[model samples]
Target: MSQELIQAVMVLTKQKGFAPEVIFESLEAALLQAYRKEPHSNPDAYVELNRETGAYKVMAKKQVVETVEFPETEISLLDARKIDKRYEIGDIVEADVTPANFGRSAAHTAKQMLIQRLKEAERSVVYEEYYSREGDIITGVITRVEGKNVYINLGKTEAILPPTEQIATETYHEGDRIKCYIVEVKKTTKGPQIMISRTHPGLLKRLFELEVPEIFEGVVELKSVAREPGMRSKIAVYSRDENIDPVGAC
Candidate 1:
């Protein structure tokens, strides 16, 4: 890699919220793909970066042999000795054979591999970030409507608020702002999927938690919640602090 390439990679890593090590790992996999394109290129290659210079190198392993059966796996002792004098049969030798550009086709392969790895990394990040938010309330903007289901944009992810999960009296339109409870979070091939509900009992509890400080502070406790999605719900509450009025708090 050159200075220009390193700078470009750094910019992309920061912009895409990817770690440098991840980008470099993807680069290593990309280089292996580039090697696959060139038969002379070593498959058993180790990619390393210069600590001081910030340059990349491709290393190869060559095994010494008396009579070479597999040309790629074994190298004659005579040829091995030319690279290193202490070469012995079955001994593996490491060689440097880094290529420049690796041709347009190889570069394209590397780009595609990097993109695929980056997408997987992004999905993992989204899943880890949202998984813990189950049962919590999230504010979202309605983005689309497909039949009875509404898709809401919640910053990092789009949540599906199904018809069965919607409140009975409330109506939504595109760009309408709404709050929903995160009923579940699932990992799919596309990305992290957040299933939200407007009529879940958890939604009312969470809304109360947001509206009343006593519940949030643990002075008032919500004992039970039951709901008929899209209709009405029931909640039972108790207060550890006798001085606190649970109903008044709500």
Candidate 2:
């Protein structure tokens, strides 16, 4: 079972691109929750997992006192000395209390919890990745058209091209490759909601930056752009070097 758990972690790490420590921490938290659900469980208990061996143990913390008042949270100095002679009354002792049947009972619950944690991690990753790309141009394939919204597959995630952001004269269809400017990226319960646009003037500026080397290299500055979506567009440009003609360079 330990080997199987380690194997699953390795597989998920490779497939999901998650750090091993993240998965281990999540699994330990899940197991801790499962252990706490058991009858007469110690409230101060924590699960310690061996990353290399995939072995785990449930440990409960008890403070050493001259007299034991709460058996669950306090241990007599004499008892603490029995475990370790250097133990003092003010010290805390952590004892192993892993149940014999804990592995079997907690496996299912831990697996479910780990899956939920990974999904949340994935959403966070996607949100951060897309958030940094806001205001940039991205190319994607149109996957589907639902009502007035066009869904584009951008490899890692999907983007939405709503009616308000679409070109009025242009029609969208599935399997068509298109480029759109990312207007906004919002974190939602479902995932990152990426709002893209085909009619935005930023799209024209981005296209110019991509196709025009002078604009991209800062030799010619693209001051502003005015667009009519599928109709026509105009741009204002200037160059710092008098030798370079900004209009011709573009």
Candidate 3:
């Protein structure tokens, strides 16, 4: 079971591009929760997992005191000294409380919890990745059209191009590859919702940046854009160098 857990974590880390530490932390937390629900579990116990070996131990933290008022949270100095002779009254002793038989049901519960945590982490990673691209242009293939929404497959995730964001005269079909400007990115319970647009002025601005070397290199600046969806659009431009003609560059 321990070897299997380690192998699963490694597979997920490689396939999902997630850091190993993130997976380990999530798994440890999940296992800790599962351990807490066991029959003889201690409230003051925590899980210590070996990253390399995947072995885990549930340890209870007890403070050494002259008088053990709380048996669960405190240990008498004499008892503590028995475990470790150097232990003092004020010292903290971590006692292994791992179950002799951590049943199959408990392991199953831990697996489910780990899966849930990994999904949430994946959603957060996807949200942050697309959120940073909000105002940028991306190319994707139209996957499907549902009512007034067109779904585009952007390799890693899907994006929504709503009717309001589409060009008035344009028609969308599945398998058609197109470019869109990312307007907004939202994190929802379902997942990351990427709102893209075909008619946004930023789309033309981005096109200019992609096609024109002068604009992309900062020698030519695109001042503003006025567009009428599928109709013609106009852009104002200026050049930093007097020798460079921004209009000719465009």
Candidate 4:
């Protein structure tokens, strides 16, 4: 077991918000990668670590045989018995070979691999959180404008407001703050693609639901909505109880 390696793994796990086991697994893979680069290397090297003590070992599997043709697979029966006494002719033995010969390059590569994997994991988490927020209102600041599309920064992600979704009378510049309704959500190969709109009728309904307590509390229900972008919008409402005035509620 490498105490320094275990400490480093713990630090990295905390920094990346990843579990300690994941970090240890990445370390084991890095050790195997380094071991595979040399001559007389075992192709099938397995490693395991004790979660309590952080003790780890690297072992190679070899078949027990009277005569050895391939040294990598077959080993003399006497050497196999030294590691494990229960070893028979058809049995396999595990030989420990944990050493500190992993080069600086291999260590650096392992660090990069860990960082990249953690980033992908974090992105997946953020995507799952935002995916449930589809067809809802999100506030953002206008970051930049490209041709006709505006990019709005929504904390973790930037949403694209296309020309078709923008209100005609609303002119936006950089640093301007606005709230838009999420019209659609798509998962692209890169990440989540959130299509936001200011002209959508759903935005009006959502706004009324936010402004009125009765609509949100189930006292009044929003039936239908229609909008004319920046001009005007009409929303139909109905109440479950006849005593509740739906129009007055909004």
Report how far residue 123 has shifted in candidate 3, in Å: 0.3
Cα lDDT tens digits, model 2, 190-249, are: 988999999999999988999999999998999999998888899999998899999999
Candidate 3: TM-score?
A: 0.91
TM-score of each: 0.81, 0.91, 0.91, 0.76
User: Worst ten-residue run, lDDT, model 2?
Assistant: 67-76
- Ranked candidates (lDDT, high to low): 2, 3, 1, 4
Task: Compose the digit string of candidate 1's lDDT tens values, residues 62-118.
Answer: 788899877655688998888889989989977666666554455677778878888
Candidate 1 vs. true structure, TM-score: 0.81
RMSD per candidate (Å) reads: 3.2, 1.9, 2.0, 3.6
In every candidate, how many clashes are there? 0, 0, 0, 0
Q: What C-alpha lDDT, on a 0 to 100 scale, does residue 83 get in candidate 2?
A: 89
Worst 10 residues of 1 by lDDT: 48-57
Question: Which 10-residue window in model 3 sums to the lowest lDDT?
Answer: 97-106
Please estimate how well model 2 matches the true structure, expressed as its whole-model Cα lDDT.
0.91
On TM-score, who's better, 1 or 4?
1
Better of 1 and 2 by lDDT: 2
lDDT of each: 0.80, 0.91, 0.90, 0.79
Candidate 2: misplaced stretches above 4 Å? none
